[model samples]
Target: MGTGTGRMASVLRGACMVGTMVLLAACTRHGHEGYARYRTNCGICHHGGEGMKGEIPPVSGRVDKIASTPEGKQYLMHVLLNGLNGPLQIDGVRYNFSMPPFRAHLSDEEIASILTYLATRGDTRPAPVFRAADVAAERAHPMTTTMVAEERRRLDAIHPLP
Candidate 1:
């Protein structure tokens, strides 16, 4: 009876150890997935700040500024979903470029995750998850005349006064 009980104890301990390892592996994988998602999506446009036409400003070091403010958050989300054209001013420099909206291309969760990663680590926003519902609602709203106008007005107000 004693030998049998010892064997069971060893087996249980091994199982617990394996479970812990599996959980750890899963967490590591999730982290990698977040990074990969950013690379796959935002990497194309904002990857290290090389704009498509040498007109877009470098966004690599500007993630913090973009993520840290209320208006900044709105602007980033709007640009991501709707794209920006005309002159865009940030941190006193004008990026006289237009970023086409990405509403049809990316889902909110992916945007959220990419923004969260970039803002917190890359841009250093300090608080990254600023516009969760805004992104969601914008994603749902019709991209028509009235809705676009309202959103543009609201976003303009929120954007840092240049």
Candidate 2:
């Protein structure tokens, strides 16, 4: 740990921090915050939409179908605001994991943006875009994570994803 080595390390760290800030700022300025937020918050676990060997579900097809309907839209928004747990099955695959709620971590617009991002990730016919108000309405009447799971079940029964 010579002085030169320490100084070089510090300089590298500072450069990395500054670069990250600039990248984040660009996303905000360019209206790519949804993609940025998803990468920062959800990408690790979901592997950027590819599930981790079935422990997680890809945020594609099924969610797109869900977001397309009114009840399904509300349910998805609730899941976003309150979070969801698993022992859940989707499209014949079983996934067991806990999804922490983002009610506090994200603003209404941010949540809508994430949802909109997910909804358009694939070639989902009639991709539905989310409004911040859609998220705000769900945020107002907060549902429990457990309640969200129940709603998922009801939604599954009524609108079972293909």
Candidate 3:
């Protein structure tokens, strides 16, 4: 083969390799197939109604307001791991919802992937990537029941639940 042709072939091969790697990484980290894990578990109550009165707020667009800030993201992650049942105010709307914690139900990596999926597709906020390390650290320092009660009191102080 001519030197020029050989160089061109090498370039094409390199480009093809890069493209394939990118596609594989994307498939592994995102899109429809990426949702299989969450759908099987969290989608149970998060997607819609359960008729439990004050249980399971739809996890779709409702997370937008909270997911916009780091504190909010932390709060959501904490709640998912710790479970919160009481009053929650989102964008001035009160939701008397109770969320069952998933600490025991899911591994840190699994929870992180679920959070990433929700942040990516469900909310308008910037995609929130919950790394397994973050999950582990957060799980290690869980929000105590007392802390949750205090948080509620503080929120109520600011915006009384109706």
Candidate 4:
């Protein structure tokens, strides 16, 4: 609170400006296509960000660690672009299902945005690492869903994800 009326008005204006900025930033992050596309492509299977009875894996609250490493990032890129199939395990649970690829359906940027969104969803001051160029670089080595699964297998063998 300000002591004088002039000071009070200035403080109120400053506070309102800050509030507006935060609101806009939040809306931009949450309402952006990254989230909407994620909902469309992933939310159904990963209902509420959790796995579906050990079939479809959860996409939220599980990516920060995965996005932290070089190999993990590579695995994530291939998984999204190529679609992961065959047997998979997470948190000591066995999951044998196919994750449909979006290489044909989505652009490199779209995929990048989605992965960036996943990696940074829990971040308060989100700084995205995934980029269209990164996706494009991986795009050069287009692997089948099974191959993507193998990539993940190799990644896990070297660096286990949590």
After superposing candidate 4, which stretches have Cα over 4 Å from the reference? Answer: 1-31, 122-128
Question: Which tens-of-lDDT digit does each residue in 85-155 have in candidate 3?
Answer: 75655445456765667888888878777777666665464566667787888899777644755665664
* 1-162: candidate 1 lDDT, tens digit per residue: 699999999999999999999998965665465468768766676664444444556655556665566666665676677765655455556666556666788778666666665565553524465345667976775454334435545655766432
TM-score of each: 0.59, 0.77, 0.68, 0.78
Against the true structure, candidate 1 reaches a TM-score of: 0.59
Worst 10 residues of 2 by lDDT: 26-35
Pick out the ten consecutive residues of candidate 1 with the lowest summed lDDT. Answer: 142-151
Off by over 4 Å in 2: 1-31
What lDDT, from 0 to 1, does candidate 4 have?
A: 0.79
- Model 3: lDDT to the true structure: 0.66
- For model 2, how does the per-residue alpha-carbon lDDT over 1-162 read when each residue is reduced to its tens digit? 999999999999999999999997864653487788888888888877877756988785566888778998899899889999987887778898899999999999899888887887767766788899878878999888889999989888997853
Q: Write down the lDDT that model 1 would get.
A: 0.62
Q: After superposition, how far is residue 157 of candidate 4 from its true place, in Å?
A: 1.4
Judged by lDDT, which candidate is best? 2
